[model samples]
Target chain A: MTAAPTIFLPEVPDGDDVGLAPSISRFELERFICGELPPERRAVIDRALAADPALKALHDDVVAADRAFLIEQPPLPFFQRPAKAPSWWAGLLSHWHAGLGAAAAAAAVVVVVVVATPDESNRTKGGVEGPRVSFFVKEESAARLGHAGEELKAGDQIQLAVKDVDKKALVVVGVDGAGSVTVYASESVQGGLSKGAGSPRVLPASLVLDETTGPERFFVVYGDDVDTLLQAVDSAARHLGDDVKAGRADLARTDQLPLGAAFPQSSVHIVKIR
Target chain B: MSISQMKDQELLTGLYRTHGGRVYARCFYLLRNKEEAQDALHEVFIKVHKNLAGFRNEASPLTWMTRIATNHCLNVLRAKRAPWHEKYKQEVDVGVAASVAGGGGAGFSLLENRELLRLCLAKVATTDGSLAELATYAFVDDMKQADICVLVGMSAPTLRKRLREFITICRAEIEAHVPGVVFAPAPI
Candidate 1:
């Protein structure tokens, strides 16, 4: 009988224990576990969990915790609901404070003009020459938007383009009309846009103004702090009344507020849809 | 006031009607305790009302509300206790070691996969930082291999090798907890 040849395989390398990648943030993990990731991204996590026992186990626990809470809690009562800013009527204060010289600027230029360069102090100490922000409206068959306010009608598609947001800032966006104000985008610049790294930031979804839509005011505030801007909007909305109009001056007015102290270099653009 | 803004309060009321139940459920789930969850319900709804205008409907309203609820609860928990990362990691390490030592083979309900999975990942994170990083990026962050490699600073061959090792460990753990649940051998 021939002796069987013996083959030896070396022990599998356990791999070097370098620290985690900076890009894989704790927030990202929470979002994944909570099912907040889009389908394509979610699949990536699903595959990894499937192949890795430890990750699968961790995912299981997160799922379990979520399930436990869902199972144990009772429905909340209506009266228990917290106070919120009214949605429909454009607050007069918000309309009044919509921009710096908003009323005047809005009256002067019926068309929206995007300011490419922000105030020097507002610019990062040595940041890349800021991102160019433009508004586009889908009119007729083509998406035509030369400036901020260029005649928008019912069912018109509204989109915003932010160029060169090299990942240093955040973008907060909202639409305030006589009826209601809607925040379209607010988050880190990376999340607000749909393009790849180094691409111009564009709103992920195209907003279509419905039939009831009237003189909708769009404001794009570019800076570092989203929460602060949100608070400012809240404060402005609270004191506002129904008569406040959407003017370019209201948009410019934001740059002069104490809130602008934190976002000195921030660009606030307002567009009115009629 | 414009028509839409006029309906803002009504819109919020409508939102409560549609999503209040699920929001409370999510708050309780993360908070674990009832009282904390209840407080979170009010805080979360207020946040919802303020941000309601910004919601672009890119995601379902329920999903948005759930996120808000979860964030509120997480913040509350963070404020009340020690850092979750350190606490969870320390506890997870000990549990993972015990499980791997051939002692955790008792019958666990297949339905308890979520709890088991959480326990197992904590252990994995402690034992192998590289593996843990890979698992987090791949499973938690859901980054593609190319992106992960760039982020982790690993070559394709090295990443592939590390991934294989991670899978083997994970599979073993699964088999230990629930026999035949993963990678069952084919019949002869």
Candidate 2:
């Protein structure tokens, strides 16, 4: 075999000649800002910033950018996995049900009443004495009942609890800022809603608000036929049309669906701010 | 103390408050798009959160996060499938020509120019992903070889060998793109 072909190679300059760009790295600046750097390193950065107007400007930019981001996108409940109901709450529920006779402790009985007294703070929009729906917001590891027409931002996590309604199926839907109607929580059209009779029981799954800005209206309807209720809600939403979908008109107008007096319905609306 | 002790939400919020700007800036620099940088920032932090336990005191938090962001952005660029050499053909050609005109066969150093460094990274990544990563620390970050060894968890000899392999690939790429252009043997 012929001799191996000679490979040509380029000459690399000496370390001294290699011109590494003279500038403060973003990483260094971040560590300095967060107090992660040693005092000596901080001094180095301080001197550099003082010596270079560009570096000073960059430092200011970094601070302002972080501030704006924090203000605009504060950590919301949806960012973390939905926390389970506290163990104390579960223990209390078990104890209360154990104390009451099995006959008196029907699954349909409102457990929320035993856990916490009902107040205006626990109610959603159009809070009434009889069968109704309420909303709760989880924040800072605590779940608080949401106020009527609460102003929430994108990424906020919310749970809906229904109370005092005896029905085979329950359907919950929301008209979002885009005016599109979505079924928030419900069972299959044929199966109806899950846990229809339990008063003040939270519906399964927490809803993380989407990045749409405007009014979002939610409707809770409970009845025997899930399909009919869905149809009625869909028809009413379509009737509301572009004005409601575009968020130009209020979603409350669809509160009185053609489903008539047969099915009980309640509505709550929230303003989504940027 | 390890970052693992912090709760997920608290850690995430703290990371965002402290280093989000720098990560976003790094992503934007690499990707050259504001929206893609924002998306990359969120993805990088999610990775940071997942790998929080692996964080050591040897590397500063920002240094570790920068490595993740750089790698993530490089992968994004690699996934784009755009021919980086072709994308920066004019700039590379002009740079090579200028370097050659200076005579003495000083050779062209891709490390000096960010665009050229990106082109080399994109080209080298196709053949060897790890080598491309090593090349990034050597060239883009201007990290010392010894520091690179510590950062990449490679011994000095291994780091040198991999870097040589990376430089070889980069040379071939440049030769293929700008025929007859000489390259300075990169200082490892």
lDDT of 1 by residue, B23-118 (tens): 665565444455566667767766876787786463556546655665565555545444554565455445444443433333222112333444
Model 1, runs deviating above 4 Å: A1-128, A139-142, A164-171, A175-181, A189-198, A212-215, A223-225, A236-258, A264-274, B1-188
What docking class should model 2 receive? incorrect
Q: Which stretches of candidate 2 lie over 4 Å from their true place?
A: A1-30, A48-274, B1-7, B54-59, B82-109, B179-188
lDDT of 2: 0.58
Q: Number of clashes in model 2?
A: 5
How do all models score by TM-score? Answer: 0.31, 0.48
True contacts kept of 1: 0.01
Model 1 lDDT per residue over A1-274, tens place: 2221111111223433221232333334445665557888777666766776766665676566556543333122122111243322223223222221322233222223223222122212224543445555544444444443345554444455555444434433343444234444444454534354334434433444434443434444445545555556444443331324444334323332233434423233334344
